[model samples]
Target: MPNERLRGAVSARELTTQRCAELLGVDPKTVERWITRDRVPHRAHRVAAADLLGVDETYLWPSVVDDLRTVSAGRAEMVEFYPSRSAVPLELWRSLIQQARESVDILVFAGLFLPELHDITQLGERARQGCRIRVLLADPNGAAVRRRGDEEGFGVGLAHRVLLSLRYYEPILAIPGVEVRLHDTTLYASIFRVDETMLVNTHVYGSTAAHNPVLHLRRVPGGRVVDHYLTSFDRVWTHAKRTSDINAVIAAFDGR
Candidate 1:
């Protein structure tokens, strides 16, 4: 079940030593020998196992997982680094968002990454279950968007993306336990958190978001990283305009 909890560790098919050996045209004893010796299969067999099991090699060998895990309290618990935003599994995202008990917070431009990917009804159910959802999106017409556009030479392209992102959640503006806001300030990083776990996507100049590194951090006692990120989310949420008032916020920028 622990392996099941990890996205890439489970297979759609049965994966026993006999099954793996059959896939590799080897004896079951060969597979058992590798397991007993605490070793992985050879390169070719490893690939075959991964193929038959429908998992990544890293998923089978946690010690060699490409993702980084930072140690704390000498326990090496509660921090991860996915190679890229897309590399983080959709299941993990859904699991975190659906399991939140206290709060689910998101701060980003257009907010398309999460909103567009998930079912709004499921999110509403989470709210009905007492999880507070706060979403902050960049105001397409705001100064921050303009600066980013000018800096990136994208002009209206970035602004249009923000507008599109906002529309994804417009229908859920009235959903209980869910609140949306539009922020005008410079966005340093995009943050998505569900209760104690937080995923950070830092902005890199001239680079697309999908190409950026992602840091996944779980709350640890006296941990400054998670604390700072949550604090920042709170601060931004305070200054952001409510979804219903976002038009007024934009009008002020347009000198309406």
Candidate 2:
């Protein structure tokens, strides 16, 4: 049977067999065989081709599940772990945002530290440079925010902090390629993803997010950890309300 997944991935990338071969340093006939004859390439070629096509290697070759090395590579996805979110270096945060070429996706309650630590204008600049940015902040007026506030002993302060953070984001909300949404869902983890690399801050009961542990993950082929969080982010984003009128959102919260 032909490897339709490989054929589709290459076609989706608009890459001809000859172009794929050129990039992979293989003959066009070999590339064709991989797709038409369902020939599984060597481990190195598998990784390289997957990276080029922007899909998991296993998706192209299901037989990879039997490869223990591929499973090991998935576990290696966690690049580092910080004892607390505050323990992460400021430079590292800046580097991650600065190096992003494709997308920057953030899901948090307030994430007030972001605009405070780094100039939020950089996000606008990034959007202008063709990078898609999506930010999901908790709805200040929602029950989830109030409940989180009570859990953290912040009362109504968490809502206020989210408002303040929204002010910082207001200017960039109108930027093309940038989207800001408000989600009322209980956020289990705060995700800051810059392209394939992500910083995941896991929330704990009765603890402030700044004190929470953070996992630094870079997406690797067949990695389940990063994809799991990414999927969560997308789910929240789907149900989140897009904020087009910043003043209206604030007014609604204030009126409530």
Q: Please, what is the TM-score per model?
A: 0.65, 0.76
**42-103, model 2: which lDDT tens digit per residue?**
98899799879977777899898778877887788989999999999999999888888899
Q: Which ten residues in a row have the lowest lDDT in candidate 2?
A: 221-230
Residue-level lDDT of model 1, residues 1-256, one tens digit each, is 2233222332346467676677679898876765655465565665566556655555565554332332342133247788788888889888887788989899887656676678766677788888898888887778887787777778767777776666666666677888988888787788999888889888777765666788888876423467567777888998998766545544554562
**Candidate 1 collision pairs:** 71-76
True-structure Cα RMSD, model 2: 5.3
What C-alpha lDDT, on a 0 to 100 scale, does residue 46 get in candidate 2? 90
Rate residue 30 of model 2 by lDDT. Answer: 99
Give lDDT per model, in order.
0.70, 0.92
- The TM-score measured for candidate 1 stands at 0.65
- Residue 247 shift from truth in candidate 2, angstroms: 1.2
